[model samples]
Target: MSRDTRAVVEELLRRIAEGDHERTAELFAEQLDWRLDWPADGHPAVPWIRPRSSRADVADHFRSLSAHHVPELNGTSVARILVDGADAVVLGEIVQTVRANGAAYTSPFALHLTVEEGLIIRYHIYEDSLTVARALSA
Candidate 1:
Protein backbone atom coordinates (compact mmCIF):
# COMPACT_ATOMS: atom_id res chain seq x y z
CA MET A 1 0.00 0.00 0.00
CA SER A 2 1.21 3.49 -0.78
CA ARG A 3 1.97 5.93 2.03
CA ASP A 4 -0.93 8.15 3.05
CA THR A 5 -1.00 11.92 2.75
CA ARG A 6 0.19 12.33 6.34
CA ALA A 7 3.25 10.24 5.66
CA VAL A 8 3.95 12.20 2.54
CA VAL A 9 3.55 15.43 4.45
CA GLU A 10 5.88 14.27 7.21
CA GLU A 11 8.53 13.37 4.67
CA LEU A 12 8.04 16.73 3.01
CA LEU A 13 8.57 18.48 6.35
CA ARG A 14 11.75 16.51 6.91
CA ARG A 15 13.11 17.71 3.60
CA ILE A 16 12.29 21.30 4.46
CA ALA A 17 13.96 21.01 7.88
CA GLU A 18 17.08 20.02 6.00
CA GLY A 19 16.73 23.02 3.68
CA ASP A 20 15.53 21.18 0.60
CA HIS A 21 13.42 23.96 -0.83
CA GLU A 22 12.87 22.56 -4.31
CA ARG A 23 11.66 19.18 -3.12
CA THR A 24 9.57 20.77 -0.38
CA ALA A 25 7.86 23.08 -2.84
CA GLU A 26 7.04 20.18 -5.15
CA LEU A 27 4.85 18.47 -2.55
CA PHE A 28 2.21 21.16 -2.43
CA ALA A 29 -0.85 21.46 -4.66
CA GLU A 30 -1.02 23.99 -7.47
CA GLN A 31 -2.40 26.62 -5.12
CA LEU A 32 -1.45 25.84 -1.54
CA ASP A 33 -3.12 27.59 1.38
CA TRP A 34 -0.85 28.92 4.14
CA ARG A 35 -1.41 30.83 7.36
CA LEU A 36 1.23 32.19 9.71
CA ASP A 37 1.09 33.62 13.23
CA TRP A 38 4.46 35.30 13.39
CA PRO A 39 4.92 38.83 12.25
CA ALA A 40 7.46 39.26 9.48
CA ASP A 41 8.73 42.35 11.30
CA GLY A 42 11.46 43.76 9.06
CA HIS A 43 11.53 40.73 6.82
CA PRO A 44 9.43 39.63 3.89
CA ALA A 45 5.80 39.63 5.02
CA VAL A 46 4.25 36.88 2.99
CA PRO A 47 1.05 36.58 4.99
CA TRP A 48 -0.28 33.67 3.00
CA ILE A 49 2.32 31.29 1.65
CA ARG A 50 0.25 29.34 -0.86
CA PRO A 51 0.97 26.56 -3.33
CA ARG A 52 3.91 25.38 -1.25
CA SER A 53 3.50 27.85 1.57
CA SER A 54 5.19 26.27 4.59
CA ARG A 55 8.55 25.92 2.90
CA ALA A 56 8.94 29.57 2.02
CA ASP A 57 7.41 30.94 5.20
CA VAL A 58 9.68 28.82 7.35
CA ALA A 59 12.80 29.84 5.48
CA ASP A 60 11.90 33.51 5.52
CA HIS A 61 10.94 33.45 9.17
CA PHE A 62 14.30 32.01 10.06
CA ARG A 63 16.41 34.22 7.83
CA SER A 64 14.71 37.49 8.70
CA LEU A 65 16.82 38.44 11.74
CA SER A 66 16.31 42.14 11.16
CA ALA A 67 18.55 44.35 13.35
CA HIS A 68 20.49 41.41 14.65
CA HIS A 69 21.37 38.35 12.64
CA VAL A 70 20.41 35.85 15.31
CA PRO A 71 22.00 32.48 15.59
CA GLU A 72 20.82 30.39 12.67
CA LEU A 73 18.42 28.01 14.38
CA ASN A 74 20.65 26.24 16.86
CA GLY A 75 18.55 23.09 16.94
CA THR A 76 15.10 21.78 16.09
CA SER A 77 13.49 18.53 17.16
CA VAL A 78 10.13 17.29 15.97
CA ALA A 79 8.42 15.97 19.09
CA ARG A 80 5.41 14.34 17.48
CA ILE A 81 3.63 13.75 14.20
CA LEU A 82 0.09 12.48 14.44
CA VAL A 83 -2.24 11.92 11.52
CA ASP A 84 -5.95 11.66 12.09
CA GLY A 85 -7.26 10.82 8.65
CA ALA A 86 -6.43 13.82 6.45
CA ASP A 87 -5.46 16.13 9.28
CA ALA A 88 -2.09 16.01 11.01
CA VAL A 89 -0.43 17.63 13.98
CA VAL A 90 3.29 18.36 14.27
CA LEU A 91 4.86 19.43 17.51
CA GLY A 92 8.47 20.52 17.82
CA GLU A 93 10.96 22.59 19.77
CA ILE A 94 13.26 25.26 18.37
CA VAL A 95 16.27 26.90 20.02
CA GLN A 96 17.94 30.02 18.72
CA THR A 97 20.56 32.55 19.80
CA VAL A 98 19.91 36.22 19.47
CA ARG A 99 22.84 38.02 17.87
CA ALA A 100 22.24 41.55 19.07
CA ASN A 101 21.66 40.71 22.71
CA GLY A 102 23.57 37.44 22.83
CA ALA A 103 20.62 35.68 24.41
CA ALA A 104 19.13 32.31 23.68
CA TYR A 105 15.68 30.79 24.07
CA THR A 106 13.87 27.61 23.27
CA SER A 107 10.32 27.72 22.00
CA PRO A 108 7.83 24.97 21.39
CA PHE A 109 5.65 25.01 18.31
CA ALA A 110 2.64 23.20 16.94
CA LEU A 111 1.57 22.99 13.31
CA HIS A 112 -1.81 21.75 12.15
CA LEU A 113 -1.98 20.65 8.56
CA THR A 114 -4.83 19.41 6.39
CA VAL A 115 -4.07 17.62 3.15
CA GLU A 116 -6.52 16.71 0.43
CA GLU A 117 -6.03 14.95 -2.90
CA GLY A 118 -2.32 14.60 -2.05
CA LEU A 119 -2.01 18.35 -1.69
CA ILE A 120 -1.66 20.57 1.36
CA ILE A 121 -4.87 22.55 1.67
CA ARG A 122 -4.48 24.30 5.01
CA TYR A 123 -1.57 25.20 7.32
CA HIS A 124 -2.04 26.58 10.82
CA ILE A 125 0.77 27.48 13.18
CA TYR A 126 1.02 28.09 16.93
CA GLU A 127 4.12 29.37 18.68
CA ASP A 128 5.30 31.69 21.41
CA SER A 129 4.96 35.22 20.12
CA LEU A 130 6.85 36.66 23.07
CA THR A 131 9.83 34.42 22.46
CA VAL A 132 10.07 35.74 18.94
CA ALA A 133 9.89 39.30 20.20
CA ARG A 134 12.61 38.73 22.73
CA ALA A 135 14.85 37.14 20.17
CA LEU A 136 14.34 40.01 17.76
CA SER A 137 15.07 42.56 20.44
CA ALA A 138 18.35 40.86 21.21
Candidate 2:
Protein backbone atom coordinates (compact mmCIF):
# COMPACT_ATOMS: atom_id res chain seq x y z
CA MET A 1 0.00 0.00 0.00
CA SER A 2 1.38 3.39 -1.02
CA ARG A 3 0.76 6.68 0.71
CA ASP A 4 -1.11 9.49 -0.97
CA THR A 5 0.63 12.54 -2.31
CA ARG A 6 -0.66 14.83 0.42
CA ALA A 7 0.42 12.50 3.20
CA VAL A 8 3.92 12.16 1.81
CA VAL A 9 4.30 15.87 1.32
CA GLU A 10 2.92 16.67 4.75
CA GLU A 11 5.34 14.28 6.39
CA LEU A 12 8.21 15.85 4.54
CA LEU A 13 7.12 19.30 5.62
CA ARG A 14 6.74 18.20 9.22
CA ARG A 15 10.21 16.74 9.29
CA ILE A 16 11.67 19.88 7.84
CA ALA A 17 9.83 22.08 10.31
CA GLU A 18 11.22 19.99 13.11
CA GLY A 19 14.76 20.58 11.78
CA ASP A 20 15.27 16.89 11.26
CA HIS A 21 17.25 16.95 8.06
CA GLU A 22 18.41 13.34 8.10
CA ARG A 23 14.91 12.02 8.74
CA THR A 24 13.51 14.30 6.08
CA ALA A 25 15.79 12.71 3.52
CA GLU A 26 14.19 9.35 4.29
CA LEU A 27 11.01 10.63 2.68
CA PHE A 28 12.76 11.03 -0.66
CA ALA A 29 13.78 8.48 -3.27
CA GLU A 30 17.32 7.19 -3.48
CA GLN A 31 17.85 9.29 -6.56
CA LEU A 32 15.89 12.49 -6.95
CA ASP A 33 15.28 15.06 -9.66
CA TRP A 34 16.07 18.04 -7.48
CA ARG A 35 16.47 21.64 -8.60
CA LEU A 36 16.60 25.06 -7.00
CA ASP A 37 15.95 28.29 -8.87
CA TRP A 38 19.48 29.60 -8.86
CA PRO A 39 22.08 30.24 -11.51
CA ALA A 40 24.34 27.47 -12.77
CA ASP A 41 27.32 29.56 -11.77
CA GLY A 42 25.87 29.47 -8.24
CA HIS A 43 26.19 32.15 -5.57
CA PRO A 44 29.41 31.80 -3.65
CA ALA A 45 27.75 33.09 -0.49
CA VAL A 46 24.63 30.94 -0.63
CA PRO A 47 25.87 27.43 0.03
CA TRP A 48 22.56 25.57 -0.07
CA ILE A 49 21.50 26.82 -3.50
CA ARG A 50 23.11 24.06 -5.52
CA PRO A 51 22.33 20.91 -7.46
CA ARG A 52 21.16 17.93 -5.46
CA SER A 53 20.49 14.40 -6.73
CA SER A 54 20.72 11.70 -4.07
CA ARG A 55 18.89 11.50 -0.76
CA ALA A 56 22.10 12.26 1.08
CA ASP A 57 22.46 15.45 -0.88
CA VAL A 58 18.97 16.44 0.14
CA ALA A 59 19.91 16.16 3.79
CA ASP A 60 23.08 18.07 3.13
CA HIS A 61 21.17 20.89 1.49
CA PHE A 62 18.90 21.38 4.48
CA ARG A 63 21.77 21.10 6.91
CA SER A 64 23.78 23.65 5.00
CA LEU A 65 20.77 25.99 4.91
CA SER A 66 20.40 25.75 8.67
CA ALA A 67 24.09 26.21 9.24
CA HIS A 68 24.15 29.53 7.43
CA HIS A 69 21.02 30.93 9.08
CA VAL A 70 20.06 31.97 12.56
CA PRO A 71 17.85 29.06 13.54
CA GLU A 72 15.81 31.05 16.05
CA LEU A 73 15.06 33.69 13.43
CA ASN A 74 14.28 31.32 10.57
CA GLY A 75 10.66 30.74 9.72
CA THR A 76 8.36 29.66 6.91
CA SER A 77 4.75 30.56 6.35
CA VAL A 78 2.96 28.12 4.04
CA ALA A 79 0.09 29.83 2.27
CA ARG A 80 -1.31 26.66 0.74
CA ILE A 81 -0.67 23.18 -0.55
CA LEU A 82 -2.20 21.84 -3.73
CA VAL A 83 -2.19 18.18 -4.54
CA ASP A 84 -3.24 16.20 -7.61
CA GLY A 85 -2.47 12.51 -7.87
CA ALA A 86 1.28 12.17 -7.48
CA ASP A 87 2.05 15.89 -7.59
CA ALA A 88 2.04 18.40 -4.76
CA VAL A 89 2.78 22.10 -4.86
CA VAL A 90 3.52 24.12 -1.76
CA LEU A 91 3.20 27.88 -1.76
CA GLY A 92 5.04 29.61 1.05
CA GLU A 93 7.26 32.44 2.16
CA ILE A 94 10.57 31.94 3.92
CA VAL A 95 12.26 34.33 6.32
CA GLN A 96 15.81 33.89 7.44
CA THR A 97 18.52 35.87 9.17
CA VAL A 98 22.00 35.14 7.90
CA ARG A 99 24.44 34.19 10.61
CA ALA A 100 27.35 35.69 8.72
CA ASN A 101 26.28 39.31 8.30
CA GLY A 102 23.17 39.42 10.50
CA ALA A 103 21.19 40.19 7.35
CA ALA A 104 17.59 39.17 6.88
CA TYR A 105 15.84 38.10 3.68
CA THR A 106 12.34 37.10 2.84
CA SER A 107 11.48 35.09 -0.26
CA PRO A 108 8.21 33.73 -1.57
CA PHE A 109 8.69 30.13 -2.59
CA ALA A 110 6.92 27.48 -4.60
CA LEU A 111 7.95 23.91 -4.05
CA HIS A 112 6.80 21.24 -6.50
CA LEU A 113 7.10 17.66 -5.44
CA THR A 114 6.13 14.42 -7.13
CA VAL A 115 5.56 11.49 -4.84
CA GLU A 116 5.68 7.87 -5.93
CA GLU A 117 5.58 4.87 -3.64
CA GLY A 118 5.49 7.15 -0.60
CA LEU A 119 8.74 8.77 -1.61
CA ILE A 120 9.39 12.09 -3.30
CA ILE A 121 11.21 11.63 -6.60
CA ARG A 122 10.85 15.06 -8.10
CA TYR A 123 11.71 18.12 -6.02
CA HIS A 124 11.81 21.55 -7.57
CA ILE A 125 11.91 24.77 -5.57
CA TYR A 126 11.26 28.23 -7.02
CA GLU A 127 12.19 31.18 -4.85
CA ASP A 128 13.58 34.70 -4.92
CA SER A 129 17.21 33.88 -5.51
CA LEU A 130 18.24 37.48 -5.87
CA THR A 131 16.91 38.37 -2.44
CA VAL A 132 18.64 35.40 -0.88
CA ALA A 133 21.89 36.24 -2.64
CA ARG A 134 21.77 39.84 -1.49
CA ALA A 135 21.09 38.80 2.10
CA LEU A 136 24.15 36.59 2.07
CA SER A 137 26.40 39.37 0.89
CA ALA A 138 28.01 41.85 3.28
TM-score of each: 0.69, 0.95
Q: Which window of 10 residues has the lowest lDDT sum in candidate 1?
A: 42-51
lDDT of 1 by residue, 81-107 (tens): 888888888899867675656777788
Give stretches of model 2 more than 4 Å off: 1-3
> Candidate 2 has what TM-score?
0.95
Counted clashes in each candidate structure: 2, 0
Q: Rate the local accuracy (lDDT) of all candidates.
A: 0.62, 0.90
Tell me the TM-score of model 1: 0.69
Best by lDDT: 2
Pairs that collide in candidate 2 are none
For residues 1-138, what per-residue lDDT tens digits would candidate 2 score against the true structure?
224899998899999988999999999999999998389757898888888899999999989988999989977889999998899899999999999899988999999999998999999999999999998996
